[model samples]
Target: MENFIIYMAKASGLIAVFYLAYHILLKKETFFNSNRWFLLAGLFTAAALPLLVYTKTIWVDPVPMAETATRTVTLEQLIAYKQYQQQMAEKAAIEAAAISINWFDVIVGMYLTGVLLFSIRFVLDFLSIRRILSGNIVMKDGRFRLIDSEKARSPFSFFNYIVYNSAQLKQEELAGIIIHEKVHSSQKHSIDMMIGQLFCIVFWFNPLVWMYKRSISQNLEFIADAGAIQVMEDKQAYQKTLLKITVQPDCINLTNNFYQSLIKKRIVMLNKQQSKKLNSWKYAAVLPLLAVFMLLFQVETVAQEKQPAIELIKLPEAKVKFAVQIDKNTQDSELEESKQLLKDEYNADVKYENVTRNPEKEITAIKVTVKDKGQSQVYEVAGHQPIAPFTIEIEKNNSGRNVITFGNSIGKDNFVRAQAFRIDANGDLQDLANDSMHVQKHKIIIGSYGMDGDKMPLRSSVPLKVPEGHWSVNSLKIGDTDMLIVINGVKQKKGDAIKLPLGQEIAELNMVKAKEAKKKYG
Candidate 1:
């Protein structure tokens, strides 16, 4: 809806520009036929120019970073993170529900209402012309239909039908009026009037559109007057005939009325001398004006270049070991279970610092030391252990193989959760869960599964709060893999999803396996 409004605005601006140009350069010229076509061309160009957009891409040097580190999180830390996210989501939902009105929706409704009213007006005008033509045809021929009716106050032409009150005009006056109406019928000036009416209906709010329609009507009248004068013997008699017919109060909007309010201008144009052939060059000015508008509104510039890949640094070889020392009173089974728990859950060796005993002699609290390359960092735990901050450094070992090291942060704000993955030589993700050399294929799906109340879920990188029946995809990984993103059934190019700006909520989202995607999309 917003996009449509913007397009209308651009089109309206173009219409205004074209009309202003026409009024200044060619409106006074004795080029009625040329002016008629030029006005019609302006309407067409205004409607089409905004849609012809050109995208331009530019490349530039990437910013350099001194160092970069990935993050490795434990299962407990992941669970804690999810809980925190859920709390934040609930708080946001409460705040959103407190709001009462949406101003955007109100504005859209008002605009549509205006459009409806104007459309009805257009239809009424058409019907009015239709009713006047019915049962009033006095003569019918291949060239035109002649309608004699008391309902028509002044001489007017709509398409092939020319309407006039035969009893009110002298035979000589009728002859001149018929000639003018015939020109309108032959040239199909009513088609131009109807087109202008439609433009006015759609853009009823724009004063420029109303003026544009007037300009079209006036030029068409000028053309009809010129055509009438060429056939008549005395031009002054035709001018006098135009002056004799007073402008009617019941003039139909969709027809060419003989006695228009611009009667004085019509008389002036009738006496005006022929324009020079070279004055036709004024029409060429529209080309440059159109070019200027295209540059200002239709061109889109984008930066297409990406940052260079980071180079991995080499680190010294370090042997890591885990040992859980127990007292003579501790059972061998309990000791072995503790060692396995550290290996399976923590995925790292830890040194026990301060172990507190409960009333039953069981450990209640413990301060654990995690070591990386002989550098030890201690973290105290009570009942529930919060996520320990750590960073994973990517480097090469002595054998020139890629190595991933997990340890406490070496600098402030250096730690981040494991979100980055590197593609190996065989186009597989390196399995950080196991050895750095191990690679596997992974599938990741990110989308919303349901709506939040009446509101639809938005596709975003961050997590959002949804009701009980809904679930949004924050991030999901099955095996180790690259993702194929399809929005509204269209498969996007690599990195396009990240660059695309989403302004609307996601309506529906689905994920298909590689085999299914290939078969369905191909």
Candidate 2:
């Protein structure tokens, strides 16, 4: 919805620019036919220009990663960490619902309401014209069907039908009006009026759109006036005939009416001399205006190369075995469960050794030993200790890409360290790179290349640098979850920690509760 509003705003601005050019450069010219076509073309250009997009590519060096401290934790602590995160998420959701008004929803509702009202008005205007044409035909000819109606205060033409009140005009005045109406019918000026009306209905909120509609209506009249004088014997008499007709309230907006409010301008236009053939150069000015509009609103996508792909080699799998020494603290049920889990999940064998107990018959000590491909490791624990279950698996996803996972699991909670690979035709694994996976660095350019060149950079894909001595979120974490950090008013995403300024560059640092943060940011 936000994107749609932005598109409409850009389109409206284009229409305004096109209309301004016409008013200054082409409106006064005697080229009525040219003016008519130009106005129609302007509407089409405005509607289509913003949709045209160009893509470009640029290459830069990848940014280096900043070093940070890391830590290892037991399985029990990982489970507690996940539970804390779930609680925080539920709390944030509750606070988000507390917001009284969503401005986006309000704006969308208002826009839809306006569209509904204008749509109804458009339908009524069409029905009003249809009613006037019914049961009112007085004469039928090969070219037109003439409707004589008391409701029609002035002469008007709608497609092949001409409507007028014969009782309101003299014989001589009627002849001139018919000639003008006939030109409108022959040229199909009603089609232009209908198009203009539709634009007005859809863009009712834009004042520029209304102005554009007026320009179209006025140009159509001028074309009809020009066509009429060419066929009539006396040009002066036609101008006087235009003055004789009293301006009445506008008829249905769908029709081309003879009595327009611009009668004075019509008289002046009729007396004006023809413009020089060379003055047609003014139309060329539209090319530059169109170029400017494209440069300002058109979207451009650019990509740049920074580094080459890294080759990877697959190694043979290794056999793993585990040895455990049970104490009173190690329940028989837990030991059985852990042994079954290692077998099912990792294809590993587990064996129990000597058991020990204290004077109270409670678990006093436990020991574990691991052997993988002939390499062995041992660890001893006294009292309660967490033993994390580990796994290594190779699988293919829905896209047929190979996924390798090395992780520790506790029920539904998985601490994963994984990578995706694509098998080439030679049956060798290759890294899968995409927009989310950066193999190189790039800068995106979105404006016109000829006008703005590479000066207008929307953003850089390169990592930002943090000043020395700055306190950054690179090392900040909430258990296995990354901490949500905000600097100045901008919330920082993962990997944005390196972009922070130095401690002295920062004037203040503050933190808020999860609920407060959710309410303000959401």
Candidate 3:
């Protein structure tokens, strides 16, 4: 809470200063009519930052299941996992690859910029006030200093510690205005106005807000006059003084005045009958909104911390062998979509890339990289996507790139489904697929597991979230591993290689049997 308050204060202060500078540069005036808005926006934005971060936070699952068809091969059939080993290496990669807005620049960069800009504005205002005070105009050597402004002919602010044109009035007038300006400074009204002006910066388009802001300034004057009544003993003399000062049509709206119409409002307010106040029972009105906000943002404390689910199954000690062809250009601004499984299942991570599109310049035909790995390996970021026939056999084809995924696969229990965890600024993830099997990036292919959610098998889950052109596939190969997965969209991997499984099928018969047994026996 403290940290968010500080940031909010910084944001408010920045906006206040920015508008202050803008007015000074162009209009030579400062307005303070943005009170509630600045306070509300600051509080709201600060509170929401943590929530946004939580939505993007990465989660990983490690699922292990026995490989049924994979047969163990040593120095004899080991030729492949070993033979192809020299061809691939790993480098830095993004799971939710940040195309342009990396984590650092958004969080840290924007914060620094906000703070520095506010500091500069503060210094400039300080220097400008000192210069104005030195001008020695109407109240030479007196505390009150006047500023030339087109917006308010007589509007003045007490924050700068200068009284604008107080010397021009008579002794009685000066006394009243002095009391008003002093009240403004001592009561901390300057800060209120400053904060209000900050709100105005954000809602400059709201005309009602602008009028309300001006009204608030005038009302503050009335309130101050009421306070002055507490000090002055003679009502007639004070009223006379207010009348004299009110004659000057050129009045400063910002600075408290000895003879402002506040005197009339004050008299009226003092004379008016007081309305009965509402009882505390009125508080019930906000119960629904408060309940909603709490549900959306309140963090819950877990009473019993359930251990994280970790499922492991030993392969019959064999590596999978299968083939899958993916279309290039179907994944951009890739995001993770989580699905729940019921029986023993292994997750196959399929990350796509279009690095060939260029980091500094835009181009056609993005390169996608796919790395495949299952939950069986720990401490090793091992994975593979089906390599193009040429890239795998031809020594000259070694020039292509391969995306590195987190150990390749997370984990699973039943079927796989897509929930669309992210979308690019352009709406959907950018598609670069060129293969015939791949969709056109705006359409998504969906298949059902049965009629019910709980009935979805470990092999036949559907695509819950689809972009254009993503279809369904059941069984396929990730590099040398023959794995079954759902297809979302087939995207290109490093250099023109295509690798992405969105709507695919899961064909783990052993796992299916386990689920079937559990259902029948339990």
- The top-ranked prediction according to lDDT is 1
lDDT score, candidate 1: 0.63
Model 1 spans with C-alpha error above 4 angstroms: 62-80, 306-522
- The 10 consecutive residues of candidate 3 with the worst lDDT sum are 388-397
Per-residue lDDT for 247-319 in model 2, tens only?
6566778888888887999888888999999999988898987787677667475756455233222221211
The better candidate by TM-score, 1 or 2, is 2
lDDT of 3 at 43: 33
Q: What is the per-residue lDDT of model 3 for residues 67-160, given as tens digits with 9 covering 90 to 100?
A: 2321111111223333344344322344345467566556555656655665565556556545554545443234544453223334345663
Report the lDDT tens digits of candidate 1 across residue range 418-509: 22333344433332222221111112222212211221122212222221221212123333234555554455454432222211223222
The Cα RMSD of model 1 versus the native structure comes to 17.5
Comparing candidate 1 with candidate 2, which one achieves the higher lDDT?
A: 1
TM-score of 3: 0.38
Task: Score candidate 2 by lDDT.
Answer: 0.61
Give the least accurate 10-residue stretch of model 2, judged by summed lDDT: 443-452
